[model samples]
Target chain A: MIKHLAAASLLLTTACLAIGPAAAADPGFTDTEILIGDVEPLTGPPALLGVAASIGHKIAIAEANAAGGINGRKIKYVLEDDGYVTARTIQGVKKVIDVDKVFAMLGISGSGQSIAVMPVLEKSGIPTVIDVAPVKFLWEPARKNVFVVGQSYEEGIVHLVNFLADKNPGRKWGLITQDDDYGITVRDGFDTVVKAKKLNVVYSGNYKKGQQDFSSDMLQLKDAGAEVFLAGGIIGENIAMMKELEKLGIKPVTGIFWPGRIEPVLKLMGPAGDGIYAVDYVEPFAGAAGKAFLEKAKPLVSEAEFKGINRYTMTGYAAAKVLIAAIERCGKQPTWACTISELEKTKNVETGVMAPISFGPGVRFSNQKLQIMQADTATLSFKPVD
Target chain B: MQYLVQLLISGLAIGAIYGLIAMGFAVIYKSTGLVNFAQGEMTMITAYIAWTISTTVSGNVFVVAAGAILAAVLLGLIIERLVMRPMLGEPVFATVMVTIGLAVILRSAINFIWDAYPHGLDIGIGRGIVHLGSIGVRTGQIAVIVTLLLLLTAIWAFFRYSKVGVAMRAVAADDRTALLMGISATRVHALAWAASSVIAGIGGVFFALSYDLSPAMFQLGLKAFPATILGGLDAVLGSGLGGLLIGITENLAGGYLGSGMKEVAGFAMIIVVLMVRPFGIFGERDIERV
Candidate 1:
């Protein structure tokens, strides 16, 4: 009787070990639902980006769930507003990880916010798709569970400088940038390309973030005799700089990054925004895919939310598509490891919003190609520069 | 020489707007002995209100500005009665802290309503450049300078000659004594706020005409703080002149040294002036009895 009992115990132990390796437990996953978390600036100045991104994520997730969720488990998405602040982002991430126990994260906004939550994400080994703020620091060293969508400002500027140099060679260039990480990244790109191409660089000036007066900077550039200027600023700064340039009567062939390509900027700049060039990775809302995205998104979100869509919305949608695709590829019994493995192996996935995306081992940043666009004063819209 | 003149003109134009905003701060501080930190947010909110009026009501610049100013005056009166009047007789620091809180609340409210995007004023200014001999001046710049001088003259005349203005001055001197002398301190405070709000509203309109309308434009209020300090927190006309001085200094520094020196130049001038005259160029010197 003792021998029989020992044999039975050994058999039970072997069965438990076999089941442990095959069926892994996920914290936020249940038989009917899979939970996902998002940390974004839903309240601050950058809230436009966050609001649009949230709508994009929601549309994509709703579409997926409507079509039958991955592996028979519907996704439950949760978002926390970080106000574009670093400290708040840390708390948001902690709450999502510890309290909400989300299986993964999507739509992480702002470069500083992303950097702040990097440690928490790494320690937890949760899959995160950063849709907004494609800063190089987030993916250059390539963390295990992190994947980045969209083009970095550095890469976008590099492409822009190359395009500008190819089009107008030997033009004396100057830079008027904001004094922040975003401006520094743009400057780095400009410096690298200018040195490599031996282009003439006349001046470089940086102003504090949120600075409205650009007269001094414009005059300095005008004094330096710069023929072409790169405006390394965001929406408001770009418009202010252009207005100041017009006020100073210094009409240099200005070049701007992706942020300056929005409708609000064109409207604010009015006729002055004419002839300015921008480097963009995603197509405008007027594109075929973008129209389709809007139409599909219209039914899913409110009219006001749909109207708020911008270029960032495409990236947000594409990110959700990638996340959904990875989960679908996980087959049955999806866990964090399976989702990450599928994501690492993802290749040439088309989302009808932007260019094709691919990721592999130790590789991140899915899209790298950028298009040159010129602002049309007649239409107040940006068209691809041939 | 052309570059220098251009810088000077642009500097003075920007300084004029700063002076207008500074006067707003000075008026409130003089009347209530409380620093209204929400002065900048008030300017920004009023600018947005003007923009909304332009879009929703009439495209005429004058009408939009008048409507915005009216709205601003009402807002100022309401805020004074609802938010500040309750804190009367409180500690000065506590009242000052309340103003800071009000600033945050006002900024958040604007963000909630406007959604943090740049809007064009399109008030028919800053569109063309007028060449004054070798120096070029933007029409917007000219408008700003002229309007500021006229507004300053009007404010100076009112305070120097008007009966209500005398009552306000009396209240500023001694609220209890003013009350004993048949001057209503509450009425004086309300009038001061309303006047300040109107001045801020005008500044906001010109600022939006010069640059794009944005919530961050409120930072201009903080930048104007040095001007108020340089002029004298209690001296309205002096603050206006101080703003021009700071603006010119900043522009010259930025032009000769670099763009980074603009802010430094303004603050450095303030420090030098304060070290020499602690009460400011036009501030009253107090004699305390031991």
Candidate 2:
């Protein structure tokens, strides 16, 4: 009878344990460690873009761990590649959330990829910081668990215009961009500056994405006498436009957004893209902050990667730094709620490479200020000027 | 009027590239009775091969062109032997699926070998601009236009006069009858692939010149598809011309209509044309949809 009673009590104990509450630590949280992961395009056509951004994440995470991590809990980071496709992005995000059970996510990805994974991010309620593309809708609606640490295209354009206008002898600002969302964003930004500053506007032309020839657009812009040009074309389109403009023997004072600051774009632009200006929320590779960043980044990555660092790298680094800082504010016992509260309370935190980041209650876009840098064909790099 | 002239020149130059890809596409469809879905990937990979050859072997146009053409031909033959020959008696859908699989393999291979970075073809062959009156046209554009003209003549001559071309045409018309008449269907099919690949090679190089050479350029092949269907699937010359028409139309639409109409105009024309002619403007009525 005593043996049977012991078996029943043992079964009862097992049942109680099975139905009990989960462990005290949230999903990826532990007393001694916090697990973080990200999704980026590690393969496919956008690999160059994604890989550069991912390196930034690695460098920042490395620096954090080397600095003894957030309040003594070592940070463990995991990365999943999305190959730049929307469906793959969803799959990658889900895999990291379900499989990795990450505490939070800090990665740089394409605008479309970020937008596609929002639903997954929403369902999982994982704290995510979007880097690189900061298209407006992601932050404006203020998804509870998400924050954007990058500047929007609108802000980038605003910076470009405000910076270039003072140097330009002519006030006739013009824009030639894609007809898609990118162009619309550029147009919106241009319109805002034009209205606010009461600047002279000459011509605006929009072309379909993947439109090959730019001769017509250049001719129109030339006819309109647009001396200060804002080119909103993505990589291939930008190079093609520059070539066409060169063919026509006209080089306007041009300004492109963040993408123009990459090494490859600068290389492809060669002579034609010389003297063109670009804007970024992060420090350019030639800027003072950029120099300071190099000192921190040099020890974290290979010499080869250090040389290839561009604007995308800075964005990723900045995002990870901000996320890490917020997690650090959560102190010894970090929960998602506490981490998110700490994130909302984050303000005036200098990320070294970017403008000082700040966030507030109900506010998710952490930074808006940007700096202008001009492409130097001679050095094949971007140099910031006062 | 000068603006119109400029738009026309630009349109024709770009249209010539579309025509180049479309011609290759139409030729494979005509000869094999199987649409080569991997044609765009072929164009992209060969362009990369051309880029490699130009950079490594010689930057001279003649050497690069020769090297690219040779690579394309070999690639075509190998694909035919490995992927096409094994699926001889399969269902047409199965063949299409296989071709798609082949495309994925080729695309992945390109991604693996060349990476996703943009490479410039600064061979100096297509750099200069010519001024005809108030209009300025780039040398690359002229090369594409001239190549298309030459390709049209070559295709016309090959189909009408060349003996091997006649055998290929016999096989395309009726493979069973051609086999009974001492022409080998397999040889013709292989020849068709090789010939089409040569066109893809030439097109790829010029495309890299006309635009930027990148993995994203594989999409150019798909863009040219509307040109193929707008012409006849089997009408090689028609498909080439169709590309030019679409290019010119897109430019005119964008120039006059508020730029948004450019994409719609070309696709709308295709829908209208297909509604009128189900077999494509140049596709044969008697042939199976395959």
Candidate 3:
């Protein structure tokens, strides 16, 4: 009789051990909540940008929960601040994956920050939507579970430069970009377009990340007699470049990248920002479609958060919406695998802010379309250039 | 020649900023005889203070500058009394560590308070170009250079001629002997910090006005280190000129070479200069009796 009891207990222990692995296989999901995570800078040079991106994620999550969530499960977003440090990003990604046991990660940081954590995210089988840093390194040789949103910097630059070159014939182009992978992409795009157009490439300068001074560079550009220049830096650098250009009394056709189209850039640049051209996949928050989106967001977010909303905010929202759609497709049991598959199958999904997002098998990059806009500092907003 | 002229003016403008920050480093080092690694963060914190003042109190440059400078002096006094004074007799390494700790705390506090948001110091010398012959200079640039010159003269006069300045110098040279001679080492130390912070406050405002004010302004203070080292660390008066030289070198290297050269030129100059002159260009070498 004792032997029979022992055998029965052993059988029960084996069964429980097998079930534990199965249960935790798709963790971070409960009867009413689906936990999602994001890694943001939140402090450092890109702190404001990170804060703005997080606000976008918060608004999207809030909007979803307001509508009763996805298949009766609300999103519980966990934002980990990496402070724009790659090592911190890796640590935070590991913590969110291993410790928090998140279902997925949405909305990453700058190019370097996002790229550093790709291996860990892919290995952990996290369904990640590369929202902010839409660079090629994130999407190229695309990982199975990663979905990239928006046009890559290279793509946007290619489109903008080609268009600009055609618009302004025989113009000498001076390009200034940061000396990083992102900047390399800008140079690559510039080189490709310039070669094709047989454009006069007068001067190209590379600056360290977080460099504020551009006086010397402006002088070089002026000396080179560049009639049209691309200030291919972030918001602060663009503003500084404009100021330096003004200081030297060297006025040229100023062009900035998409990231420089935020309200802060408009505010800081003031009159200097006027007439500068920029390109982006997301429509300006001051536009008709963006107005309707803001009208919805105004009720959901605080006035300050509402005020903080910009191009990045829209991209963050669109990325979240895409992830939500995939989760919705997964219904009650929204496992990471199911969400990844659902995202891969997403085609022509429109969020009314960014370009139509499309993905399929062997294709993970979404939103290739870029829109050109001009800064109207007089109104402190962006308008689509004709 | 035209391009060189433009570069020279811009370089001098930036140099003036570095010089002011370097003067703060030199003041503390000269009087207290300890390198304040926290000088950078001090400048950053004071820049934020200046921004707050400008935004809230007045947009007038003088009003903003005065408010920031006064606040900086108070900060210096409070820090010296509460932190530095307590470590008066401690090992030099320990006190320096405390300063390092102070820097971390100040930086974190600034981050917590400001979140690294960029604030345009609209209370600035106008960005209008002031053309001199064929060379165009911004009014802001002229203001920075002029501020540097005026402060340099005032600081030079005070250290050279004032009774308190000589006392501070005696204390720095030999605190034990100076105390015996009725010079209060504590008083001199406190004064050194206040005066250093005054320079920091001015530097912070101009640095912000030249660009924008944010936590990142701390980097300017660090960059000024090369200037202090290139000048005599104890030669407070010479440090500002050292800053200008470094700035000019960086700008010229950037102009002739590339943007990457700009950052390297200053540090490289420091290395070359130190190999030749261990006490910097103007630093006094101490003789020890065997």
- Look at candidate 2 and give me any clashing residue pairs: B232-B283
**What are the fnat scores of the candidates, in the order listed?**
0.68, 0.54, 0.54
Higher-DockQ candidate of 2 and 3: 3
* Candidate 3 lDDT by residue in tens digits, A123-211: 88889888887888888898999988888888889888977887889999899988888788888998999889899989989998767
- Report the Cα lDDT for residue A258, model 2: 78
Q: How far is candidate 3 from the true structure (C-alpha RMSD, Å)?
A: 2.4
Q: On residues B65-136, what C-alpha lDDT tens digit does candidate 2 reach at each position?
A: 888899999988988889998888799899989989888788877666766677887687786778887667
Chain B superposition TM-score per model: 0.97, 0.96, 0.96
The estimated TM-scores of all candidates read 0.94, 0.89, 0.94
* Strongest candidate by lDDT: 1
lDDT by residue for model 1 (A1-386), tens: 99999999999999988897555566777889888899887775687788778777888888888988878889889999887889998999989988999888997978878987899889989988998889888898999999998888878898988888888887898987778888889889998898899999888998878777878888888889999889988888888888777766668988999866777788788677898999887876656766788888888878777777787777788899998899888876777899898999889998887888899988877864688888887776778875
Per residue, candidate 1 scores C-alpha lDDT tens digits across B1-290 of 88888789989989998999999999998898878999998998898998888888887877987899899999899989999999998999999898899988887786678776678787565556788985667777788889889988998888899998888888988899999999998998998899898887788888888777876778989988899999999988889888899889989988888977877899999999999989889988877879
Task: Give the residue spans of candidate 1 off by over 4 A.
Answer: A1-24, A30-32, A71-73, B124-128
Model 2, A1-386: lDDT tens digits are: 99999999999989878755344356886767888888887666677677778788888889999989888888888888777778888888888888888899976478877887888888877888888789888898998889998778888888788778768744787788787677888888888878887888888888887676676677777778888888888777888888888877789889887775676777776689998988877777666787888888899999867755667788888888888988888777677887788888888888888778888999999766776777898877788775
- The number of clashing residue pairs in model 3 is 0
State, as a TM-score between 0 and 1, how close model 1 is to the true structure.
Answer: 0.94
